[model samples]
Each structure stands twice: as C-alpha cells, then as structure tokens.
Target: MATLVATPRSRALGFGLRHAREARGLGVRELARLAQVVAQDVSSWESGLRVPKLEQLGVLFGALRVAPPERARLVELARNAREPNWLERSMPGISPALSTYVEYERTATEMVNWEPLLVPGLLQAPGYAEAIMRAHRLPPRMVEREVAIRLRRREVLTRHDPLVLKLFLGEEALRRSIADPAAMAEQLRLLVRAAQPRTSSIRVVPANVGYHPGQAGHFVIFDFAHLPSVVHIEHLRGSAHLYDGDHVAAFRAAAETLSDLALSEQESLALIQGVITGLE
Candidate 1:
C-alpha cells in the first residue's frame, strides 16, 4: 500500500521506473508478473507512494530492460529514498533535482512562493527569465533549453484544476532594473494579469518591513492533496528539497509570517502598476 510520506527522491526514482517500463513497451501487469509482484504494488511504486527495496529494484529494473547507466542512477535514488532532505549535487547519470522538483510542482495542489530578489520562476516572463539566465553566463544552448523548460512549467498554472498559488514578492523586485525596460515592464504586467480573482494571489512585502523570517532566504512550499507536503529551498549552488515534518513546518511558519507582512492583494497590484508606470 502507498503512504503519504513518499519523498521527492522516491518520486523521482518512480518516475524513472515508469519511464523505463514504458520505453520497453511493458504494461504494469506485464512487468508486475515478470517481477513477481501484484500489479497494484507496481502502480504504487510508479506513483512514488511506496518504495521498493533494493532487491525489488534489481528485479524491476532487470525486467524493464533499463540501461546500466539509468539503472545505476535509479538505484542510487532508491538507496536514499528515505532521506528527509535532498541536496541537488552529484546526482549520477541524471539530474534528479530538476525531475524531483518538477514532479512535485506538477502534483502539488497548492503552492506558496516567497521571492525576495526576483520574480518567482513559474511566473517569470520569457524575456525576464532569459536576462537572468544570460547574466549567469550560461551557454546559449543551455539558456534556450532552460527558458523553454520554464515556459513549459507555466503550463501547470493553467491546466485543469489549476494550482492554487500564493505568491509573495518583495517590493524591490518590482523596481529592480533589468537589461530591457520593456521586458521588465512586461514582467510586471504579467504579474498584474495573473493576480486576479480566480488566478492567484500576488502580494508585495515592503523593503522597510524590519527583520522577518523571510529575510533569511527565499523558499517555496508545495502542498499535496493526498500526500505529505514538501518544501524547496534554493541557494547559490543548487536547491534542497525538505520532506520531514519539522523542516516543512518551519517553512510553513515562514509563509505565515510573510502573509502577515505582505501588502494586501489589491494594494500589491496597485504598487506593481505604479512600478510599471515608472518603467514606462
């Protein structure tokens, strides 16, 4: 049976397992019979609700005809499936952090984002995103690839049963100057459009709001309908996903703090519009 404590790493491993099975043209029952497990357990493993043991992973991967490289990567994920937090570094064969985050994002029923320095990734306009990526000095191809991926991520916001998002932006984020004024204005405009009644709540935290929990850093909280919540903390090198109760609670408290300090949705919209006026 599947449980709510499935970690993002487990989900990534499950994603890999499902991909490998589909690539080999094996259905759940077909693979389950080959691996000597019930079809429901295979479904549970593929959905990340339950993790198979190391021995079971061997049987499953062997049955799926997964390549050595991918099998090694997935096996590594299974090895750490119970870890409470995941630091996005030194992942073998594939970049599981991106996969893990994307899977969490897609499945999360509600998302609370706090960005002090820039627009949240999901809401970033293409030009604003490209400017930030180029500033990082990423190669042209990588920039294009990331930008395209970001655009795809936005799809989640508008899909059926769209994500219930609470976005808290720092006041300075609206005024910060980017390479292109038009793009910056457009970015703010995007914020205005997305901050409507049925879309999302976009609020701003004034810079002078002395010392708050969010001052420590930016983070995102993803809440799932039938599973445990996950918190994502992004830093200079990479990001970390937190799945344990204490860590997730700390971030949730931070979200509550930001909610108290941020401007009202309407006020935030007015201030954002004012910034757009300044840019023009």
Candidate 2:
C-alpha cells in the first residue's frame, strides 16, 4: 500500500498569503487582529505549518486585501490542499517540503541549481543515485524507491517543452567519486551529454576559485511565468522554501555570483570529459 503524504498546496497558499500581507505593509499580529485570529495562527499559516480554515482564510484574505485573481487562486489551493496523487506513491521518503519543491519543479519554466556535493537529483543517473542513498544509510528498499523516483524526476529534462535548466556544480562534485567507478563514469558521461546549450546549461566552479557564495551549500531557485519565484534550501534534516522577496533576491544574487565564477560551458564539458577519460 502507498503511504499518503500531504500535498504542498498549503505551502503555496501560505506563500501567496505572506506575499500579499507584506505588500500591504502589514505585520502578522496586525493582520491577525484585523482578521480576528491569533497571531500564532497567522505565523503558522505563513510558515506552511498549518492550513487556515475556510472562514479564517476568508477573513485573512480580506484583511490582507489580496487582489481578486490571486485571492481566487489561494482559495482554490486551500480547498484542494490535501488531494492525493501518484507522487506520494513514487517518492515514499520525501518530506512535505520536498513534495512542494517537486511541484514547483514540475511547473517552473526555469530552474537554477547550485550543487556543491553530489550531482543534482534531477540529473542523477539511477546507479549514482542508488549509491548516494546507500551512502546515506537508507534501507535497501528505500534506496531502490528513491532511485526510481529520481529517475522519474529526470523526465523533466526530456519533456516536449522542457524547462530551461541552469546547473552549477562545484569542483568537488567531480572530484568526489561514488563507490562504483563504473557508475561514476556513467554519471559523468550523462552530465556531459545533458549539458546542451539549448535545453540545459551546465557550469563548474573550480576548487581554486577561493571562497564564494556557492560554498554555502546546495539550493535551487525555481522561476515561473505567472507565479512568484521561490528558493529551496535542503539540509540533512529537512528543507526550507524561501518566499520572501528579499530572501529570494539574495539567493538570486548568489546564483549570479556563482555563475560568473564558474567555468565556461565548453570548459565545464571538457572537465567532465577529462574525468570520464580518467575512469576509462
């Protein structure tokens, strides 16, 4: 039986609520007072920790003065927040926040990834991903499930209208080999093949580049045509989705810095090819 995981719709709605409130220069307490709800409730809503009831949602939206179209969208999200789907069945160990990130990935028109450790999940080969999961001590069953989901995630790369992928990898990512040399070689070859300019742009930040923003960690920025951009930061325990304008802007600036410091597309491919040759 497939375990049911909560959808990220509430998180999306919370993001919309927080954006609407801040745009109106209203604090959580102030909005709570206007909406006749506790301040903690407002905080929980914005954090995506809780979903507001319909009545509370109505009052909160009214207090924030959300515009009609966006308000309608938020309402729809609140209404359908818990609908089940195949993602839950496929990605068994994925957290609610990650599920939300997956949804963002599915809908995003452009994705910017900064990976300092292993290869980014979307681009990971199944064997490489399995090696990674095992290294993390995941049970064999869970590792197989995760590898399957990771492979499914790669579909985004081949979709008819594929999302533009701007991938930045740290030098260490290439230097660090997974347990199996053959699998690592396959992964490197895959990376080189997927770095086409038209669909995906891949760059490598040299180890000698000295301290830079990417050293901070792995993160991804998803940009949508009609929705506000979001920054996702993953950690050992869980992940965080940053929706505030300033926070998102700061991450964007960091992405730009990393991009500027990374090796050119041709250079990165050459570096990857060199690694593959060494394995051969």
Candidate 3:
C-alpha cells in the first residue's frame, strides 16, 4: 500500500524520503530501519498525518544519502507543510474547497486572473460585489460577508510590498449590466483606477477577439513567495486546486495567449471609460 504523507511540512519531507528510498531500492521497512523510525511512522509522515522533528529529519536524511544542503531543503519543505495558513485561522468555518485558493492568494507574491462573467473579486467595488451576490441569490448576510472578504482582498493592491495583479476581463463582462447602469459605470471606473502600472493592470478581451483560450471559465494563477505556483479553477458547486507541472504549464500558456491578444492596458482603460460615458 502507498504511504500517507503528512500535512504541509511533513508531507514534503516524507515525499523526499520516500523518493530517496525508492531510488535506493529499499522497501518501507528497510528505510524505516535505516532512519531508526517505525515503518508506520514513516508512512504517516508520507501521508501528511504528522510532521517529522529535526532529529527525525536528520535520521531520514542519513538514510536517503543526502548532503547537508539538500537535507536542509527537504527539512524546509517539511516546515512549510506543517505551518498552518492564515486563512485557516481567520475564517475557520469556510468551505474546505476554498482553503487552498485562499492560502495561495494570501501567500502569493504575484496573481494573474481572468474572469468572463463578472468583475474579478479582488477588484470588485463593494456595490458591484453586492449586486452580483444578490443576482446569484445568496442570503443577505452571506452577500455582506462575501463583499467584506472581497474588499479585504483588495489590500494586496497597496501593501508595502504589493503583489502584481494582472487581470483580463471579457468584453461580455463589461457590457452586461450586473447592477444598474450607473453602478456598472462606477465599477468600470474602479477597474480603470486599479489598472495603473505601479500597482495593478487590466486588459480587455474584445468581442472581436472572438474565440480564446479561457472560453470555459475563470481561473487564477498564484505565484507564492517561495513555494510552487498553483492554478485555481472555480466551478458552480466547488473549486479545484492544481499544482502538477503539466496543468500549470497549460494555464500559463493560456494566460500568455490571452494577454497577447487582449487590448493593452491603456487601450482597455479607454474602452472602460467609453462604457462609463455610454452608461451616463
């Protein structure tokens, strides 16, 4: 049977150990004997059920035949796995499906987004957010809370070390009136204001651009401070967290293609201003 890896920290460490053991043609029992730990404990570490102490890591490293620096890297990966994300503590009762995306967002140094149906959450004006929520038929209190969360996410725009927010919005998103035309105008203005080069960027994919890569739905690619990049796909009922190399590559390609085909930042701002004027 496959061993269970531990949560964030121990999981990485355990994976490294297992990879090393497999490379050395050793079974779980043999690796456990070399590391001076029980096989079940090793399995638990691999499965993310528990983390390894520093001493335990040293033993694992010895068994894995790793040098000091490589061993340190494995240990650091394990440490990150063990650390609980801020979103886990701040919003305890939220859906589990959202936790991974939130963790990626809070820890990311760069974020790229593409939304076809509505304003991206981070850039949403409060009224726009509320209107969209109402349209979705969320309970009143839930709408308020979701709006609050969206507003809070905007802090990333002005942090001391702000993240790079590159967003692409479909022409349909801009044209459709989520709220009153006046409210939509305000939302468009907000998008323009947020698009300034220093803090954020906005690009519009014109209707003329026709078919494109992100035709299916919205997705976000998060580049974390030190961890691997992640892609988040949201659906009606749930969300998916993708971290494998191949999936990340596909999303990256799509983002690049969209960015290339979409109107430039300046042009997009002009387009949004035109919408605002028409609405007024």
Question: Evaluated with lDDT, which candidate comes out highest?
Answer: 1
lDDT of each: 0.85, 0.78, 0.74
lDDT assessment of candidate 3: 0.74
Error of 2 at 197 (Å): 0.9
Writing each residue's lDDT as its tens digit, candidate 1 over 132-197 gives 989988788888887788889888888988888899999878888864999999999999988856
TM-score of 1: 0.91
Worst lDDT window (10 residues) for model 2? 83-92
Residue-level lDDT of model 2, residues 186-263, one tens digit each, is: 999989888879989999999998898888888888887755576778766666666656778899999999988999
Query: Which pairs in model 2 have colliding backbones?
Result: none
Model 2 spans > 4 angstroms off: 1-52, 55-92
As a TM-score, model 3 comes out at: 0.68
Name the lDDT of candidate 1. Answer: 0.85
Worst 10 residues of 3 by lDDT: 84-93
lDDT of 3 by residue, 1-280 (tens): 2222323334335555666777888888888888887899878766456677778888777777887765766776665663432112122234434434554565578998999878888888988898988987888988888888887878877888888888989988999988898789889989987886965889998878778888978988888654567677776666655666687899999999899889988898899899999999
